[model samples]
Target: MRGVVMHAPGDVRTEELEMPVILEPTDAIIRVTATCICGSDLWPYRGAEAIRAGGQRMGHEYIGVVESVGGEVARIRPGDHVVGSFVASDNTCEICAAGYQSRCVHQVMMGSVGTQAQYARIPLADGTLVVTPGELPADLIPSLLAASDVLGTGWFAAVAAEAGPGKTVAVVGDGAVGLLGVLAAKQLGAERVIAMSRHADRQALARRFGATDIVTERGEEGAARIKELTGGLGAHSTIEAVGTQESMEQAIRATRAGGHVGFVGVSHDVALDGAEVFFSSVHLHGGPAPVRRFLPELVDLIFQRRIDPGAVFDLTLSIEDAAEGYRAMDERRATKVLLTTD
Candidate 1:
């Protein structure tokens, strides 16, 4: 089988690799139908996250038909069309029971090494894969795929930010996750959602996702815009989807005292001051999103055609062109890139 491998910074190649098979009682093998490049994947592609000398596999978001399942995997069966979580978890753990499946004791990150391939071995099959109701149209495939990561991550950010009726929610960052954060906030009943975006294209989509306003600013300027929108107190809730020091600080500063800040960006080179955060009086919570916790609802929403998060995917490529997909996203030429097994 062919899969994507990273040789070094900015070097991604689709090459022949061994196919995966079930190696654990809870495992399942999936024939990947659709996969994509994630913003987090850029960490390694850009050298922010080290890539070892020999090539390492890439990709973590995938939706596919189950080709096989281990004896202990009862919930998911062969031939089922499933969306696998980026983080695998045994749904039975205490943390999983509390809805934080991302922190499950048995959690294993898919694609940290690679899922951008013909097939993948998914550990904790029962807990990580959500089988869709039935076969879907080709057009809906991309939307369903987004539920595996960005959509789910944005939803978690909204929930963590406490977005709801009468709340003013502000989304920091204009990436796919931030765009979806706008959608999630609106769906969660936020009366006013502010999207802090400098890109015109992203700003337009943010509005389509129910953003009441767009702030074309950054850093302190961006924080001031949010405050101005909120009558000098800042937003009641803020979703930080870019895991950068500037984005983190912007999220914290854009929320009113006693408000909540849900951050879902893959934090890199970020350090928060304890005293500053404590004085800000903003509630902060985020990490690898517990996508499994919201999978059922998100899947239902996609199946019903109530939301189309797939619009974020502005570029598509054959699996063999995975490197181009990564370059498109890394250079910001594409908001999100989708790869199909063709």
Candidate 2:
């Protein structure tokens, strides 16, 4: 089997590797049909996140047909087409029971599963995998794949932000998750959805996703724009999808007092001023999204053709071209890149 390995910063290669097999009672093996590069994967590629283990395996989002299941696995069986959460969680855990599957005590981050390959092992199969209804249209594959990560993450951000009727929501960042955040806000019934994006292409998608306004400004100017649009009250809720210090602060400052800020970006070099947060009177919450919690509903939406979040995938490449996919995203030439086993 061939899999993506990050040898070092700016160096990712798809090379032949040992195939995976069930090593746990709760494990299942799947032949990957589709996988993709994630922005967080860039952290190591760009040297922003340290690769403590050299030649670390890459990728977490994937969808495929189950090839085998462990003795303990039930509900998911061979030949079922399934989408997995980025985090492999035992849904019955206390943490997962509290709606935070990402922090499940018995969870496994699928980045190590190396979904960017021919076949991979999925632990906690019953809790982590959601089978799509019957056979899906070829075109719907990408959208269902998005539900494995970005779309679900974005939806979690919206829920964390308390987006709902009568609420004014603002989203900071214009990446795939950010774009989906706009979509989630609208679906959640936000009265006004503001997308802070400088890119024309992203702005267009944001609009199509129901962004009521687009603010191209940055830092304080961006915060001011949110305030102006909300009549000096800022937004009732703000979604921070870019994890940078600036973006985090901008998100905090863009929310009205008593509002909430949900940050879904993979944090790199971020430090918050406690006093600033105290004075802002804004509530903050977000971490790795509990994608498993929302997978069922999102899968239903995609299966019903009610939403097409796959539009965020601007580039599709063969698994062998993983490096190019990374480069396209790094160079800002693609919004999101999808990889196919074929």
Per-model TM against the reference: 0.99, 0.99
Q: Write the per-residue lDDT of candidate 1 for residues 1-342, one digit (tens) a residue.
A: 989999999999999999887789999999999999999889988889988669889889999999999999989999999996799999898999999998999999896636899899999999999999998678889999999999999999999999999999999989999999999999999999999998999999999989998888999999998998899999999999999999999999999999999999989999998998999999999998999999999989998899999999999999999988988998899999999987
After TM-score superposition, the amount by which residue 167's alpha carbon in candidate 1 deviates from its true location, in angstroms, is 0.6
Q: Which ten residues in a row have the lowest lDDT in candidate 2?
A: 48-57
**Which numbered prediction scores highest in lDDT against the true structure?**
2
Cand. 1 TM to true fold: 0.99
Candidate 2, residue 159: CA error in Å? 0.4
- Tens digit of lDDT per residue, candidate 2, span 291-319? 99999999998888888899999999999
Error of 2 at 265 (Å): 0.6
User: Candidate 1: lDDT over CA atoms?
Assistant: 0.93
Clashing pairs in 2: none
